[model samples]
Target: MRRQKKTILLASPRGFCAGVERAIEIVERALQKFGPPVYVRHEIVHNKFVVNELAKKGAIFVDELDEVPKGATVIFSAHGVSKSIKEQAKIQNMFAIDATCPLVTKVHNEASRHHRKGRHTLLIGHAGHPEVEGTMGQVPEGTMTLIETLSDARNFNPPISDGLAFATQTTLSVDDTSEIISILQHRFPEITGPSGEDICYATTNRQNAVKKLAAKTEYFIIVGADNSSNSKRLVEVALKFGAKNAVLIPDANSLKLNELRNVSVVSISSGASVPDILIDEVLKKLDQEFDISIKIESSIKEDVYFNLPPILRTR
Candidate 1:
Protein backbone atom coordinates (compact mmCIF):
# COMPACT_ATOMS: atom_id res chain seq x y z
CA MET A 1 0.00 0.00 0.00
CA ARG A 2 1.14 3.55 -0.78
CA ARG A 3 2.05 5.79 2.15
CA GLN A 4 -0.71 8.18 3.22
CA LYS A 5 -0.74 11.70 1.88
CA LYS A 6 -0.46 14.71 4.16
CA THR A 7 -0.79 18.45 3.67
CA ILE A 8 1.64 20.82 5.34
CA LEU A 9 1.03 24.47 6.00
CA LEU A 10 4.58 25.77 6.06
CA ALA A 11 4.57 29.02 7.92
CA SER A 12 6.44 31.80 6.19
CA PRO A 13 8.07 34.64 8.07
CA ARG A 14 9.37 31.89 10.30
CA GLY A 15 12.97 31.37 11.50
CA PHE A 16 16.10 33.56 11.50
CA CYS A 17 14.63 36.94 12.28
CA ALA A 18 16.91 39.81 11.39
CA GLY A 19 18.22 39.97 14.93
CA VAL A 20 19.17 36.29 15.00
CA GLU A 21 20.75 36.65 11.59
CA ARG A 22 22.74 39.59 12.85
CA ALA A 23 23.75 37.79 16.04
CA ILE A 24 24.97 34.67 14.26
CA GLU A 25 26.76 36.72 11.63
CA ILE A 26 28.41 38.74 14.35
CA VAL A 27 29.90 35.55 15.76
CA GLU A 28 31.04 34.28 12.38
CA ARG A 29 32.49 37.65 11.46
CA ALA A 30 34.23 37.97 14.81
CA LEU A 31 35.86 34.60 14.27
CA GLN A 32 36.99 35.67 10.81
CA LYS A 33 38.40 38.98 12.03
CA PHE A 34 40.04 37.73 15.21
CA GLY A 35 40.77 34.08 14.35
CA PRO A 36 40.13 31.21 16.82
CA PRO A 37 39.22 31.36 20.54
CA VAL A 38 37.22 34.60 20.60
CA TYR A 39 34.91 34.64 23.62
CA VAL A 40 31.14 35.17 23.50
CA ARG A 41 29.34 36.08 26.73
CA HIS A 42 26.43 33.69 26.11
CA GLU A 43 24.84 31.46 23.51
CA ILE A 44 24.65 33.96 20.69
CA VAL A 45 20.95 33.49 19.97
CA HIS A 46 19.69 30.53 22.09
CA ASN A 47 19.73 27.98 19.29
CA LYS A 48 21.86 24.94 20.06
CA PHE A 49 22.57 24.20 16.42
CA VAL A 50 23.65 27.77 15.80
CA VAL A 51 25.79 27.71 18.91
CA ASN A 52 27.39 24.40 17.99
CA GLU A 53 28.15 25.62 14.51
CA LEU A 54 29.75 28.78 15.85
CA ALA A 55 31.68 26.83 18.47
CA LYS A 56 33.19 24.80 15.70
CA LYS A 57 34.34 28.00 14.07
CA GLY A 58 36.27 29.18 17.18
CA ALA A 59 33.66 31.17 19.13
CA ILE A 60 33.94 30.40 22.84
CA PHE A 61 30.56 30.81 24.59
CA VAL A 62 30.88 31.59 28.26
CA ASP A 63 28.25 32.22 30.91
CA GLU A 64 29.94 35.37 32.23
CA LEU A 65 32.59 37.91 31.51
CA ASP A 66 34.99 36.35 34.03
CA GLU A 67 35.34 33.31 31.79
CA VAL A 68 36.93 35.55 29.20
CA PRO A 69 40.49 36.66 29.84
CA LYS A 70 41.10 40.31 30.70
CA GLY A 71 41.29 42.60 27.67
CA ALA A 72 40.18 39.76 25.36
CA THR A 73 37.27 40.08 22.94
CA VAL A 74 33.73 39.19 24.05
CA ILE A 75 30.33 39.54 22.43
CA PHE A 76 27.04 39.99 24.24
CA SER A 77 24.16 37.76 23.25
CA ALA A 78 21.22 39.10 21.25
CA HIS A 79 19.11 39.15 24.44
CA GLY A 80 21.03 42.21 25.64
CA VAL A 81 22.69 42.52 29.04
CA SER A 82 22.58 44.53 32.24
CA LYS A 83 24.49 47.74 32.83
CA SER A 84 26.46 45.80 35.41
CA ILE A 85 27.61 43.35 32.75
CA LYS A 86 28.71 46.17 30.48
CA GLU A 87 30.43 47.92 33.33
CA GLN A 88 32.19 44.72 34.34
CA ALA A 89 33.50 44.32 30.82
CA LYS A 90 34.69 47.88 30.85
CA ILE A 91 36.38 47.37 34.20
CA GLN A 92 38.12 44.32 32.87
CA ASN A 93 39.02 46.24 29.75
CA MET A 94 37.56 43.51 27.53
CA PHE A 95 36.99 44.37 23.90
CA ALA A 96 33.25 43.70 23.97
CA ILE A 97 30.98 43.69 20.94
CA ASP A 98 27.25 44.11 21.53
CA ALA A 99 25.19 41.63 19.54
CA THR A 100 21.97 42.64 21.27
CA CYS A 101 18.97 42.89 19.02
CA PRO A 102 18.40 46.58 18.41
CA LEU A 103 14.75 45.95 19.24
CA VAL A 104 15.72 44.65 22.68
CA THR A 105 18.02 47.62 23.09
CA LYS A 106 15.00 49.82 22.39
CA VAL A 107 13.09 48.30 25.31
CA HIS A 108 16.07 48.81 27.60
CA ASN A 109 16.22 52.46 26.59
CA GLU A 110 12.48 52.94 27.07
CA ALA A 111 12.54 51.48 30.56
CA SER A 112 15.55 53.58 31.50
CA ARG A 113 13.81 56.71 30.23
CA HIS A 114 10.81 55.88 32.41
CA HIS A 115 13.20 55.71 35.34
CA ARG A 116 14.74 59.10 34.50
CA LYS A 117 11.22 60.51 34.70
CA GLY A 118 10.60 58.79 38.10
CA ARG A 119 7.96 56.30 36.93
CA HIS A 120 8.17 52.81 38.39
CA THR A 121 8.28 50.35 35.51
CA LEU A 122 6.32 47.09 35.29
CA LEU A 123 8.38 44.86 33.02
CA ILE A 124 5.99 42.41 31.35
CA GLY A 125 7.88 39.14 31.04
CA HIS A 126 9.23 36.09 32.88
CA ALA A 127 11.73 36.89 35.59
CA GLY A 128 15.37 35.85 35.08
CA HIS A 129 15.11 35.75 31.32
CA PRO A 130 18.22 37.58 30.15
CA GLU A 131 16.16 40.15 28.32
CA VAL A 132 13.91 40.78 31.34
CA GLU A 133 16.90 40.89 33.68
CA GLY A 134 18.66 43.37 31.44
CA THR A 135 15.55 45.54 31.22
CA MET A 136 14.96 45.37 34.95
CA GLY A 137 18.56 46.30 35.65
CA GLN A 138 18.44 49.35 33.38
CA VAL A 139 16.86 51.26 36.22
CA PRO A 140 17.78 51.08 39.92
CA GLU A 141 16.67 48.05 42.01
CA GLY A 142 13.31 49.35 43.27
CA THR A 143 12.32 51.16 40.10
CA MET A 144 11.32 48.17 37.95
CA THR A 145 8.95 45.35 38.96
CA LEU A 146 8.45 42.27 36.82
CA ILE A 147 4.86 41.33 35.93
CA GLU A 148 4.75 37.70 34.73
CA THR A 149 1.07 36.89 35.02
CA LEU A 150 -2.40 38.38 35.53
CA SER A 151 -2.08 38.14 39.31
CA ASP A 152 1.17 40.05 39.25
CA ALA A 153 -0.51 42.66 37.15
CA ARG A 154 -3.48 42.81 39.55
CA ASN A 155 -1.94 42.72 43.01
CA PHE A 156 1.17 44.88 42.94
CA ASN A 157 0.76 48.11 44.83
CA PRO A 158 3.17 50.50 43.27
CA PRO A 159 5.28 52.71 45.56
CA ILE A 160 2.89 55.33 44.30
CA SER A 161 0.21 55.07 41.63
CA ASP A 162 0.87 58.46 40.04
CA GLY A 163 4.00 57.54 38.12
CA LEU A 164 3.78 54.29 36.19
CA ALA A 165 5.24 52.73 33.02
CA PHE A 166 5.49 49.34 31.29
CA ALA A 167 7.80 47.54 28.85
CA THR A 168 7.86 43.93 27.64
CA GLN A 169 10.28 41.32 26.37
CA THR A 170 10.56 41.29 22.62
CA THR A 171 9.63 37.57 22.57
CA LEU A 172 6.22 36.88 24.15
CA SER A 173 2.74 35.59 23.40
CA VAL A 174 1.01 38.56 21.84
CA ASP A 175 -2.44 37.61 23.18
CA ASP A 176 -1.18 36.89 26.67
CA THR A 177 0.89 40.07 26.80
CA SER A 178 -2.10 42.06 25.58
CA GLU A 179 -4.24 40.68 28.37
CA ILE A 180 -1.58 41.51 30.94
CA ILE A 181 -1.14 44.97 29.48
CA SER A 182 -4.88 45.48 29.53
CA ILE A 183 -5.09 44.50 33.19
CA LEU A 184 -2.30 46.87 34.11
CA GLN A 185 -3.63 49.70 31.96
CA HIS A 186 -7.11 49.26 33.32
CA ARG A 187 -5.84 49.42 36.87
CA PHE A 188 -3.50 52.28 36.15
CA PRO A 189 -5.25 54.49 33.67
CA GLU A 190 -2.33 56.89 33.49
CA ILE A 191 0.33 54.23 32.95
CA THR A 192 2.79 54.91 30.14
CA GLY A 193 3.68 52.30 27.53
CA PRO A 194 5.90 52.15 24.50
CA SER A 195 4.68 54.44 21.69
CA GLY A 196 4.12 51.13 19.93
CA GLU A 197 4.19 47.46 21.04
CA ASP A 198 7.38 46.24 22.73
CA ILE A 199 7.04 42.77 21.30
CA CYS A 200 9.34 42.77 18.24
CA TYR A 201 8.18 42.55 14.64
CA ALA A 202 9.44 38.99 14.01
CA THR A 203 7.70 37.63 17.10
CA THR A 204 4.41 39.30 16.25
CA ASN A 205 4.67 38.09 12.67
CA ARG A 206 5.40 34.45 13.65
CA GLN A 207 2.54 34.35 16.17
CA ASN A 208 0.15 35.88 13.66
CA ALA A 209 1.25 33.29 11.09
CA VAL A 210 0.46 30.47 13.53
CA LYS A 211 -2.91 32.01 14.36
CA LYS A 212 -3.87 32.08 10.70
CA LEU A 213 -3.45 28.31 10.37
CA ALA A 214 -4.34 27.00 13.82
CA ALA A 215 -8.01 26.46 13.19
CA LYS A 216 -7.49 24.33 10.11
CA THR A 217 -4.41 22.52 11.30
CA GLU A 218 -4.81 19.23 13.12
CA TYR A 219 -1.34 19.37 14.61
CA PHE A 220 1.26 22.08 14.95
CA ILE A 221 4.99 21.72 15.41
CA ILE A 222 6.98 24.77 16.40
CA VAL A 223 10.65 24.37 15.54
CA GLY A 224 12.57 26.16 18.28
CA ALA A 225 14.61 25.63 21.41
CA ASP A 226 12.91 24.90 24.76
CA ASN A 227 14.44 27.99 26.31
CA SER A 228 13.32 30.15 23.45
CA SER A 229 10.42 32.25 24.74
CA ASN A 230 8.98 33.15 21.35
CA SER A 231 9.07 29.56 20.11
CA LYS A 232 7.22 28.28 23.18
CA ARG A 233 4.67 31.06 22.70
CA LEU A 234 4.04 29.72 19.21
CA VAL A 235 3.08 26.35 20.67
CA GLU A 236 0.68 27.99 23.14
CA VAL A 237 -0.84 30.17 20.42
CA ALA A 238 -1.50 27.14 18.22
CA LEU A 239 -3.28 25.23 20.97
CA LYS A 240 -5.30 28.24 22.10
CA PHE A 241 -6.26 29.29 18.61
CA GLY A 242 -7.74 25.86 17.76
CA ALA A 243 -5.10 23.37 16.72
CA LYS A 244 -5.97 20.01 18.30
CA ASN A 245 -2.47 19.70 19.70
CA ALA A 246 0.83 21.50 19.52
CA VAL A 247 4.43 20.97 20.62
CA LEU A 248 7.80 22.66 20.46
CA ILE A 249 10.71 20.55 19.24
CA PRO A 250 14.25 21.79 18.98
CA ASP A 251 15.09 19.85 15.87
CA ALA A 252 13.56 17.65 13.16
CA ASN A 253 14.76 14.38 14.67
CA SER A 254 13.44 15.39 18.06
CA LEU A 255 9.88 15.20 16.70
CA LYS A 256 8.06 12.05 17.73
CA LEU A 257 7.00 9.86 14.86
CA ASN A 258 3.89 8.79 16.76
CA GLU A 259 2.48 12.30 16.87
CA LEU A 260 1.94 12.34 13.12
CA ARG A 261 -0.08 9.17 12.97
CA ASN A 262 -3.56 10.69 12.99
CA VAL A 263 -2.97 14.12 11.54
CA SER A 264 -3.68 14.78 7.90
CA VAL A 265 -3.06 18.51 8.05
CA VAL A 266 -0.11 19.97 9.93
CA SER A 267 1.44 23.36 10.46
CA ILE A 268 5.13 23.99 11.12
CA SER A 269 6.71 27.20 12.33
CA SER A 270 10.01 28.15 13.87
CA GLY A 271 11.07 30.71 16.42
CA ALA A 272 12.97 33.85 15.52
CA SER A 273 16.27 32.27 16.52
CA VAL A 274 15.84 29.09 14.47
CA PRO A 275 17.84 28.52 11.33
CA ASP A 276 16.20 27.50 8.04
CA ILE A 277 18.21 24.27 7.83
CA LEU A 278 16.47 22.88 10.91
CA ILE A 279 13.12 23.48 9.27
CA ASP A 280 14.44 21.79 6.13
CA GLU A 281 15.36 18.68 8.08
CA VAL A 282 11.84 18.55 9.46
CA LEU A 283 10.45 18.74 5.93
CA LYS A 284 12.73 15.99 4.79
CA LYS A 285 11.67 13.80 7.72
CA LEU A 286 8.02 14.41 6.94
CA ASP A 287 8.54 13.57 3.29
CA GLN A 288 10.12 10.24 4.18
CA GLU A 289 7.02 9.12 6.06
CA PHE A 290 4.29 10.55 3.87
CA ASP A 291 3.55 12.07 0.53
CA ILE A 292 3.46 15.66 1.71
CA SER A 293 2.06 18.65 -0.12
CA ILE A 294 3.49 21.82 1.27
CA LYS A 295 2.10 25.33 0.97
CA ILE A 296 3.59 28.60 2.15
CA GLU A 297 1.04 30.43 4.26
CA SER A 298 2.71 33.77 4.77
CA SER A 299 0.74 35.99 7.08
CA ILE A 300 3.21 38.77 6.36
CA LYS A 301 6.44 39.52 4.58
CA GLU A 302 9.59 40.37 6.56
CA ASP A 303 12.40 42.32 4.92
CA VAL A 304 14.22 43.45 8.01
CA TYR A 305 18.01 43.42 8.41
CA PHE A 306 20.47 44.54 11.08
CA ASN A 307 24.08 45.39 10.25
CA LEU A 308 27.07 43.77 11.94
CA PRO A 309 28.78 45.78 14.65
CA PRO A 310 31.35 48.40 13.59
CA ILE A 311 34.06 46.85 15.76
CA LEU A 312 33.93 43.84 13.45
CA ARG A 313 35.17 46.21 10.74
CA THR A 314 37.92 47.75 12.87
CA ARG A 315 41.44 46.36 12.50
Candidate 2:
Protein backbone atom coordinates (compact mmCIF):
# COMPACT_ATOMS: atom_id res chain seq x y z
CA MET A 1 0.00 0.00 0.00
CA ARG A 2 1.32 3.44 -0.86
CA ARG A 3 1.26 6.29 1.64
CA GLN A 4 -1.11 9.11 0.84
CA LYS A 5 0.50 12.30 -0.41
CA LYS A 6 -0.37 15.64 1.25
CA THR A 7 0.59 19.26 0.86
CA ILE A 8 0.93 21.43 3.97
CA LEU A 9 0.73 25.16 3.62
CA LEU A 10 2.51 26.80 6.54
CA ALA A 11 1.62 30.34 7.49
CA SER A 12 4.47 32.67 8.38
CA PRO A 13 4.29 35.34 11.09
CA ARG A 14 2.25 32.64 12.75
CA GLY A 15 3.80 32.12 16.20
CA PHE A 16 5.38 33.84 19.21
CA CYS A 17 4.66 37.51 18.77
CA ALA A 18 7.17 39.94 20.30
CA GLY A 19 4.90 40.57 23.30
CA VAL A 20 4.78 36.88 24.23
CA GLU A 21 8.53 36.56 23.78
CA ARG A 22 9.07 39.46 26.18
CA ALA A 23 6.60 38.09 28.73
CA ILE A 24 8.25 34.63 28.80
CA GLU A 25 11.69 36.21 28.93
CA ILE A 26 10.55 38.40 31.84
CA VAL A 27 9.68 35.34 33.90
CA GLU A 28 12.89 33.49 32.93
CA ARG A 29 15.07 36.48 33.68
CA ALA A 30 13.24 37.20 36.95
CA LEU A 31 13.74 33.59 38.00
CA GLN A 32 17.42 33.79 37.12
CA LYS A 33 18.03 37.12 38.82
CA PHE A 34 15.94 36.65 41.94
CA GLY A 35 16.14 32.84 42.01
CA PRO A 36 13.19 30.30 42.12
CA PRO A 37 9.73 30.77 43.60
CA VAL A 38 9.10 34.00 41.76
CA TYR A 39 5.35 34.72 41.72
CA VAL A 40 3.40 35.57 38.57
CA ARG A 41 -0.12 37.01 38.89
CA HIS A 42 -1.57 34.94 36.03
CA GLU A 43 -0.50 32.41 33.44
CA ILE A 44 2.22 34.59 31.93
CA VAL A 45 0.57 33.96 28.61
CA HIS A 46 -2.55 31.91 27.69
CA ASN A 47 -0.60 28.81 26.58
CA LYS A 48 -0.31 26.01 29.15
CA PHE A 49 2.90 24.68 27.60
CA VAL A 50 4.63 28.02 28.04
CA VAL A 51 3.32 28.37 31.59
CA ASN A 52 4.34 24.82 32.50
CA GLU A 53 7.82 25.31 31.09
CA LEU A 54 8.17 28.48 33.18
CA ALA A 55 6.88 26.67 36.24
CA LYS A 56 9.68 24.13 35.98
CA LYS A 57 12.10 27.05 36.00
CA GLY A 58 10.71 28.20 39.41
CA ALA A 59 7.88 30.57 38.50
CA ILE A 60 4.82 30.30 40.71
CA PHE A 61 1.55 31.14 38.99
CA VAL A 62 -1.24 32.57 41.12
CA ASP A 63 -4.69 34.07 40.58
CA GLU A 64 -4.49 37.26 42.62
CA LEU A 65 -2.31 39.53 44.71
CA ASP A 66 -3.71 38.05 47.92
CA GLU A 67 -2.38 34.61 46.96
CA VAL A 68 1.18 35.97 46.81
CA PRO A 69 3.04 36.28 50.06
CA LYS A 70 3.89 39.77 51.26
CA GLY A 71 7.18 41.15 49.90
CA ALA A 72 7.47 38.49 47.19
CA THR A 73 8.22 39.71 43.67
CA VAL A 74 5.05 39.29 41.60
CA ILE A 75 4.91 39.83 37.85
CA PHE A 76 1.74 40.76 35.98
CA SER A 77 0.71 38.60 33.02
CA ALA A 78 1.09 39.77 29.44
CA HIS A 79 -2.66 40.37 29.42
CA GLY A 80 -2.26 43.34 31.78
CA VAL A 81 -4.20 43.92 35.02
CA SER A 82 -6.45 46.43 36.72
CA LYS A 83 -5.23 49.63 38.34
CA SER A 84 -6.75 48.32 41.55
CA ILE A 85 -4.52 45.25 41.30
CA LYS A 86 -1.53 47.56 41.23
CA GLU A 87 -2.92 49.49 44.20
CA GLN A 88 -3.47 46.23 46.05
CA ALA A 89 0.08 45.11 45.30
CA LYS A 90 1.36 48.40 46.64
CA ILE A 91 -0.72 48.02 49.74
CA GLN A 92 0.71 44.52 50.24
CA ASN A 93 4.21 45.88 49.53
CA MET A 94 4.89 43.10 47.03
CA PHE A 95 7.71 43.86 44.65
CA ALA A 96 5.88 44.02 41.33
CA ILE A 97 6.97 43.84 37.68
CA ASP A 98 4.47 44.51 34.92
CA ALA A 99 4.86 42.17 31.95
CA THR A 100 1.79 43.56 30.21
CA CYS A 101 2.39 43.76 26.47
CA PRO A 102 3.28 47.26 25.30
CA LEU A 103 0.39 47.03 22.87
CA VAL A 104 -2.00 46.36 25.74
CA THR A 105 -0.43 49.17 27.69
CA LYS A 106 -1.24 51.45 24.78
CA VAL A 107 -4.93 50.63 25.12
CA HIS A 108 -4.81 51.32 28.84
CA ASN A 109 -3.18 54.63 28.20
CA GLU A 110 -5.78 55.45 25.57
CA ALA A 111 -8.56 54.76 28.04
CA SER A 112 -6.93 56.92 30.68
CA ARG A 113 -6.27 59.72 28.24
CA HIS A 114 -9.81 59.64 27.00
CA HIS A 115 -11.14 59.80 30.53
CA ARG A 116 -8.89 62.72 31.43
CA LYS A 117 -10.26 64.62 28.45
CA GLY A 118 -13.77 64.17 29.89
CA ARG A 119 -14.77 61.67 27.23
CA HIS A 120 -16.96 58.67 28.04
CA THR A 121 -14.92 55.71 26.76
CA LEU A 122 -16.20 52.52 25.15
CA LEU A 123 -14.03 49.39 25.15
CA ILE A 124 -14.59 46.95 22.30
CA GLY A 125 -13.60 43.45 23.45
CA HIS A 126 -14.95 40.22 24.86
CA ALA A 127 -16.18 40.37 28.42
CA GLY A 128 -14.13 38.60 31.14
CA HIS A 129 -10.94 38.68 29.06
CA PRO A 130 -7.99 39.82 31.16
CA GLU A 131 -6.99 42.57 28.76
CA VAL A 132 -10.55 43.90 28.57
CA GLU A 133 -10.85 43.87 32.34
CA GLY A 134 -7.59 45.70 32.71
CA THR A 135 -8.39 48.27 30.03
CA MET A 136 -11.84 48.92 31.44
CA GLY A 137 -10.40 49.24 34.92
CA GLN A 138 -8.08 52.02 33.81
CA VAL A 139 -10.79 54.60 34.25
CA PRO A 140 -13.62 55.15 36.75
CA GLU A 141 -16.18 52.30 36.82
CA GLY A 142 -18.87 54.21 34.95
CA THR A 143 -16.58 56.09 32.58
CA MET A 144 -16.04 53.18 30.21
CA THR A 145 -18.57 50.84 28.61
CA LEU A 146 -17.89 47.37 27.16
CA ILE A 147 -19.07 46.62 23.63
CA GLU A 148 -18.50 42.98 22.65
CA THR A 149 -20.74 42.76 19.58
CA LEU A 150 -22.50 44.79 16.95
CA SER A 151 -25.68 44.59 18.97
CA ASP A 152 -23.93 46.03 22.00
CA ALA A 153 -22.56 48.82 19.87
CA ARG A 154 -25.94 49.58 18.38
CA ASN A 155 -27.72 49.51 21.72
CA PHE A 156 -25.11 51.47 23.69
CA ASN A 157 -26.33 54.89 24.73
CA PRO A 158 -23.53 56.81 26.34
CA PRO A 159 -24.38 59.17 29.19
CA ILE A 160 -22.99 61.92 27.02
CA SER A 161 -22.90 61.00 23.37
CA ASP A 162 -20.89 64.03 22.33
CA GLY A 163 -17.95 63.03 24.53
CA LEU A 164 -17.50 59.47 23.38
CA ALA A 165 -14.24 57.66 22.67
CA PHE A 166 -13.33 54.02 22.13
CA ALA A 167 -10.42 51.59 22.71
CA THR A 168 -10.19 47.86 22.02
CA GLN A 169 -8.61 44.56 23.02
CA THR A 170 -5.34 43.85 21.27
CA THR A 171 -6.14 40.21 20.41
CA LEU A 172 -9.53 40.59 18.69
CA SER A 173 -10.45 39.44 15.18
CA VAL A 174 -9.77 42.38 12.87
CA ASP A 175 -12.83 41.84 10.69
CA ASP A 176 -15.24 41.35 13.57
CA THR A 177 -13.98 44.33 15.49
CA SER A 178 -14.25 46.47 12.37
CA GLU A 179 -17.91 45.60 12.02
CA ILE A 180 -18.58 46.52 15.62
CA ILE A 181 -16.64 49.74 15.25
CA SER A 182 -18.52 50.61 12.10
CA ILE A 183 -21.85 50.26 13.87
CA LEU A 184 -20.72 52.46 16.75
CA GLN A 185 -19.20 55.15 14.52
CA HIS A 186 -22.26 55.31 12.29
CA ARG A 187 -24.49 55.82 15.30
CA PHE A 188 -22.21 58.29 17.04
CA PRO A 189 -20.55 60.31 14.32
CA GLU A 190 -18.81 62.51 16.86
CA ILE A 191 -17.19 59.59 18.68
CA THR A 192 -13.41 59.57 18.79
CA GLY A 193 -11.16 56.50 18.39
CA PRO A 194 -7.53 55.61 18.88
CA SER A 195 -5.11 57.32 16.51
CA GLY A 196 -4.46 53.86 15.09
CA GLU A 197 -6.28 50.54 15.53
CA ASP A 198 -6.13 49.05 19.00
CA ILE A 199 -5.49 45.55 17.64
CA CYS A 200 -1.73 44.85 17.54
CA TYR A 201 0.23 44.24 14.37
CA ALA A 202 0.91 40.60 15.27
CA THR A 203 -2.78 39.72 15.49
CA THR A 204 -3.54 41.47 12.22
CA ASN A 205 -0.56 39.94 10.42
CA ARG A 206 -1.28 36.36 11.54
CA GLN A 207 -4.90 36.66 10.43
CA ASN A 208 -3.80 38.01 7.07
CA ALA A 209 -1.39 35.11 6.55
CA VAL A 210 -4.04 32.57 7.48
CA LYS A 211 -6.57 34.20 5.15
CA LYS A 212 -4.17 33.71 2.22
CA LEU A 213 -3.47 30.05 3.07
CA ALA A 214 -7.13 29.28 3.78
CA ALA A 215 -8.12 30.21 0.26
CA LYS A 216 -6.02 27.42 -1.27
CA THR A 217 -6.22 24.66 1.35
CA GLU A 218 -8.83 21.95 1.77
CA TYR A 219 -8.55 22.05 5.55
CA PHE A 220 -6.93 24.33 8.13
CA ILE A 221 -5.49 23.65 11.56
CA ILE A 222 -4.72 26.45 14.01
CA VAL A 223 -2.23 25.49 16.73
CA GLY A 224 -3.02 27.31 19.96
CA ALA A 225 -4.66 27.05 23.36
CA ASP A 226 -8.47 27.11 23.67
CA ASN A 227 -8.34 30.22 25.87
CA SER A 228 -6.25 32.13 23.36
CA SER A 229 -8.53 34.73 21.72
CA ASN A 230 -6.30 35.30 18.71
CA SER A 231 -6.05 31.57 18.05
CA LYS A 232 -9.82 31.16 17.99
CA ARG A 233 -10.07 34.08 15.59
CA LEU A 234 -7.73 32.40 13.14
CA VAL A 235 -10.01 29.37 12.85
CA GLU A 236 -12.97 31.70 12.21
CA VAL A 237 -11.01 33.74 9.68
CA ALA A 238 -9.95 30.62 7.76
CA LEU A 239 -13.46 29.27 7.57
CA LYS A 240 -14.84 32.67 6.62
CA PHE A 241 -12.22 33.06 3.88
CA GLY A 242 -13.07 29.75 2.17
CA ALA A 243 -11.32 26.84 3.93
CA LYS A 244 -13.64 23.84 3.74
CA ASN A 245 -12.87 22.90 7.32
CA ALA A 246 -11.01 24.57 10.20
CA VAL A 247 -10.14 23.48 13.72
CA LEU A 248 -8.11 24.65 16.70
CA ILE A 249 -5.58 22.30 18.25
CA PRO A 250 -3.52 23.18 21.29
CA ASP A 251 -0.62 21.25 19.80
CA ALA A 252 0.12 18.29 17.61
CA ASN A 253 -1.16 15.99 20.35
CA SER A 254 -4.64 17.45 20.11
CA LEU A 255 -4.91 16.82 16.38
CA LYS A 256 -7.41 14.17 15.22
CA LEU A 257 -5.71 12.56 12.26
CA ASN A 258 -8.99 11.18 10.94
CA GLU A 259 -10.15 14.68 10.11
CA LEU A 260 -7.32 15.01 7.68
CA ARG A 261 -7.72 11.57 6.08
CA ASN A 262 -9.29 12.97 2.93
CA VAL A 263 -7.55 16.30 2.97
CA SER A 264 -5.04 16.43 0.11
CA VAL A 265 -3.89 19.93 1.08
CA VAL A 266 -4.00 21.33 4.62
CA SER A 267 -2.87 24.67 5.94
CA ILE A 268 -1.34 25.07 9.41
CA SER A 269 -0.98 28.24 11.43
CA SER A 270 -0.30 28.96 15.07
CA GLY A 271 -1.68 31.74 17.27
CA ALA A 272 0.44 34.69 18.31
CA SER A 273 1.11 33.12 21.70
CA VAL A 274 2.11 29.69 20.34
CA PRO A 275 5.69 28.55 20.01
CA ASP A 276 7.24 27.47 16.71
CA ILE A 277 8.19 24.09 18.17
CA LEU A 278 4.51 23.12 18.38
CA ILE A 279 4.06 23.71 14.67
CA ASP A 280 7.24 21.71 13.96
CA GLU A 281 5.89 18.81 16.01
CA VAL A 282 2.66 18.83 13.98
CA LEU A 283 4.66 18.77 10.74
CA LYS A 284 6.80 15.90 11.97
CA LYS A 285 3.71 13.89 12.88
CA LEU A 286 2.15 14.49 9.47
CA ASP A 287 5.39 13.40 7.77
CA GLN A 288 5.33 10.03 9.52
CA GLU A 289 1.85 9.19 8.30
CA PHE A 290 1.87 10.71 4.84
CA ASP A 291 4.15 11.83 2.01
CA ILE A 292 4.21 15.52 2.90
CA SER A 293 5.34 18.55 0.93
CA ILE A 294 5.46 21.82 2.88
CA LYS A 295 4.98 25.25 1.35
CA ILE A 296 5.45 28.62 3.11
CA GLU A 297 2.72 31.18 2.55
CA SER A 298 3.24 34.58 4.13
CA SER A 299 1.21 37.72 3.52
CA ILE A 300 3.62 39.99 5.35
CA LYS A 301 7.01 40.00 7.05
CA GLU A 302 6.94 41.15 10.70
CA ASP A 303 10.01 42.89 12.09
CA VAL A 304 8.47 44.12 15.35
CA TYR A 305 10.32 43.60 18.64
CA PHE A 306 9.44 44.67 22.19
CA ASN A 307 12.10 45.10 24.85
CA LEU A 308 12.00 43.25 28.15
CA PRO A 309 10.62 45.09 31.18
CA PRO A 310 13.03 47.74 32.45
CA ILE A 311 13.60 46.16 35.88
CA LEU A 312 14.83 42.98 34.21
CA ARG A 313 17.32 45.05 32.18
CA THR A 314 19.64 45.64 35.16
CA ARG A 315 20.14 41.94 35.78
Best by lDDT, which number? 2
| lDDT (Cα atoms) of all candidates against the true structure | 0.91, 0.91
Question: Per-residue alpha-carbon lDDT of model 2 for 243-279, expressed as tens digits?
Answer: 9999999988888888889889999999988988899
* Candidate 2 residue pairs in clash (backbone atoms < 3 Å): none
RMSD of each predicted structure: 1.2, 0.9
Model 1: residue 234 alpha-carbon error in angstroms: 0.1
Which 10-residue span in candidate 2 carries the lowest summed lDDT? 188-197
Residue ranges of candidate 1 with Cα displaced over 4 Å: 313-315
Q: Estimate the TM-score of every prediction.
A: 0.97, 0.98
**In model 1, what is the error at residue 293, expressed in angstroms?**
1.1
